[model samples]
Target: MSSTRQFSFEFFPTKTDAGHEKLMQTAAHLATYNPNYFSCTYGAGGSTRDRTIDTVKHLNDVIKVSTAPHLSCVGDTKADLRQLLTMYKNSGINRLVALRGDLPSGMGMASGELRYANELVEFVRKETDDHFTIAVAAYPEMHPQARNFEEDLRNFATKVKAGANIAITQYFFNADCYFYFVERVRKLGIEIPIVPGIMPITNYTRLARFSDACGAEMPRWVRKQLEAYGDDTKSIKAFGEQVISEMCERLLQGGAPGLHFYTLNQAEPSLAIWENLKLPR
Candidate 1:
């Protein structure tokens, strides 16, 4: 994954050796398509700390793809963040996904030095200057915690102002939501690329659970159609591919900068959509 690609993939750090092998195999397969980079997710409050560092390094070093490790400030100290930033910098990692992250369960409320994403973005910029390209999250359908759309937009604008280099949106079924969100963000005078986060539709039940938790709307028609497929994995996947692929085509045609896929550490679903789009390899 390299050379200025308009698409990229995301994976989570595996906790087991076999899982690691599968992820590596997936990365190797996706690498042939030339993603901009392979991004590995970080767990809340640094829960998956070491695995994330090790996984990111392996993907970059073994798979030879540029990797971006997600860094969140939900339950970390300034010193904790500073040390990790220094470690990554020393390792030749040049990009990061800066997030406020979810509050790890059993934590009453956020107790981190940096409570919000803008603060984290500012901290990263202050600590490392322009050394790393920082990507912040964008909620097309509004963050579940956001009071209203206006407040969410303002928060996003603040994060951008705090030195975020780019934004990757939460996955949505509606292209109109992405377009409208981008339009609103642009009205605030922020011009960084807002890449739409794509979740390949593999399992409907899991997708439903994830969407419910993340505030991503699964359109009623889409839900009903998926419901009709009931336990038929093949039909579910085929339908998912069609719907997601068509929406992706509309998004690209409507002027999205690029697509960032939440690959779930698998290659087939994403590759199915990629082939559907006939996207440059």
Candidate 2:
């Protein structure tokens, strides 16, 4: 990896005190690596907006890390988003992951004020005038709901043209998928850094479910191997670290800008992968 490449972790707001405590512990541990930033995810349809803001503030104040809070367009009005942008700017939180997040369960898309992430990016630029560094999502394996690969690439390009400064992809097992996606985007004249998202495979069942839901492909070989480990948590984690670390190595060596880990609010799995790869802290 380039020494100048950026690395970050993603976390979500927790509903319970116990969950909050665990997230804090995890954040403290990962902070040791001195990541470029830590990002807090916004819940579907702005359901956990307040909690997300709280978590972002805690990380910035207590953890003392550059924090990025996700701002989604789903279930929000332009006025609501403008208010949030003002609040975050006043709080010294200048980085944002702009997304058109999933609608809350059973909520229809027609209810949302914004229909796409590109629009959100545009609105942010119009409102803030470069006050924030905006990060947007890239789906290497084509978004599940996209009409086709070409359409997905076009959608991603739109976000970049609308003023996204960076792109973080959905996790995938195959590095080739990331490479192909980057090459296709480059053909569209977009040169923004595209960081690969890494999901450490600590639990096969949960990994499979998340992959299925997000349209990330888990290679059959990897799935069968993980399945063979069955309930052996130790074996699962061991195999996961080795596999993910190797994949990360290839991604970096092949010119990936950096990595963004989907930490699932856990430290050890991602920490192990970092150590296994011998990345500089």
Candidate 3:
């Protein structure tokens, strides 16, 4: 568990004054751990485009953290995306997470030239020349749209071939899913680091909603904890730390190259998990 491994964090853009303060504080607190990189997420349906850019700039320039801003293919034209690439380039931010984001409710499905992450990755490559290192998302438990698990893995291969340097998977509770996915991808010749994303769950019902949407499976032990401790914050926090700590230990034992925490803009829980891992500063 104490082995030297890469770590990164993901944060979302803030739209309100209070949220901005929270985002900054989260960035500052997490910065103390010296993560390998920090990423800012793009909102669904273009809701937080400006804030995404602003956050990336602030973190890179003011916070002095190496930042990767997520660029989504939702509700954006190629020209608009290119302009964002230029902005990131100018800011000395050379990394990106290309994603086909969630469509707006009632839109059925998103409409654009960049319909898939592979398309977005290809667009970035054609727009820049070795200037940007790109990462793409992976789904261990088959994406909702994929025809099957094989199709999902093939799609992942397409992203790697398209120009992805790293693949950060959607969060899941089972470590076996991640290990098996990585093994299968390696067998197929995809060599990039496939980092396991860990979610620190403090509430059962809320997590159920997210799990349903994202295809994450919650173990029965976790479910029991949530059922037993429902809204009690102290109990929830303690349970979250235990679950995540055990998961990280298993992931490390299974040879995961790194761990990426979905901090959800909070500090104490993620910080506590890191402390439990005794990770290097």
Candidate 4:
């Protein structure tokens, strides 16, 4: 494994003051590990646009680390996106995670000015001319809305061709799935770094719920093990750490570019995994 491989963490903008404080502390804690950058997720349909910007700014200003704000095309106008790009540029944020975010429940797809993530990446390049390092989403198991695996791969290639500098995948448990996805994309002539998104298993119920919603496959054995633990929080966390740590080792050994953890605004789970991997801070 390359010692200089990139590592990053993702967060969502918090709605409450307390939540914001907690996230700040979490970011601070993780910063000690020298992650490549921190990413803040934009709310669906641009609902929390202001909060996302504010959170990104706060992390950059306070944590003194490069922060990337997620920019989603759904429910946004070209003018609105232009303004946001300028704002982030002015705030000294030079990285972005471009996404075709989910539409809010009941909002039709036609409501958005931009239709896909490729269009969003194109717009960013046209508007900013490489001022930002653009990162786009990829799915190993296939995006939930995709009609099939080929279509999903093509869509990801479209984003890369549109100027995405990197690709971060949806979190998955199975290492073979990630390796296969990378090999397939390589065959498609997409060479951008595809970083595996890692979700530490802290809460089985919550993890299962999220996995189901996001199309991440939780293997039957893993599911059964988690289910057997029931409400045993300690055992669940220990088992989760062991499972995720081993997965990380395999991914790194298999030549994944790096890891991007879905921190979910917490510190310990991700930190524990980092420690388990014995990665340099």
Tens digit of per-residue lDDT, candidate 4, span 83-139: 999989999999999999988998876356789999999999999998999999999
Candidate 2 C-alpha lDDT tens digits along 1-281: 33679999999999998999899999998998989999999988898999999999999989999899999999899999999999999999989999999878888663567789999999999999999999999999999889999999999999999999999999999999999999999999999999999999899999899899999999899899999999999999999888899999999999998899999999988888888878888
Q: Give the TM-score of candidate 1.
A: 0.98
* Residue 151, candidate 4: C-alpha displacement in angstroms: 0.9
Once fitted onto the true fold, the runs of candidate 1 whose alpha carbons sit more than 4 angstroms away are 1-5
Give every collision pair in model 3: none
Cα error, candidate 2, residue 268 (Å): 0.6
Global lDDT of each model?
0.92, 0.93, 0.86, 0.93
Tens digits of per-residue lDDT for model 1, 1-281: 22343698999999999999999999999999978888999997889999999999998888988899999999899999999999999998998999999888898678789899899999999999999999999999999999999999999999999999889999999999999999999999999999999998889999999899989999999999999999999999999999999999999889888899999999999999999999887
The C-alpha local distance difference test score for the whole of candidate 3 amounts to 0.86
Give lDDT tens digits, candidate 3, residues 1-281: 23457788888887798998888988998898888888889888777898998899988888788999988898889988889899889889988988998888876778666888899999999999779889899888878778899989999999899989988889988888888999899988999988888888777788888898888878888888778886797888788888888888899888888888888888777788888988888
C-alpha TM-score for every candidate: 0.98, 0.98, 0.96, 0.98
In candidate 4, list every pair of residues with a backbone clash. Answer: none
RMSD of 4: 1.3
Worst 10 residues of 2 by lDDT: 105-114
- Candidate 1 Cα deviation (angstroms), residue 29: 0.7
Count of backbone collisions within predicted model 4: 0
Candidate 2: where is the Cα deviation over 4 Å?
A: 1-3
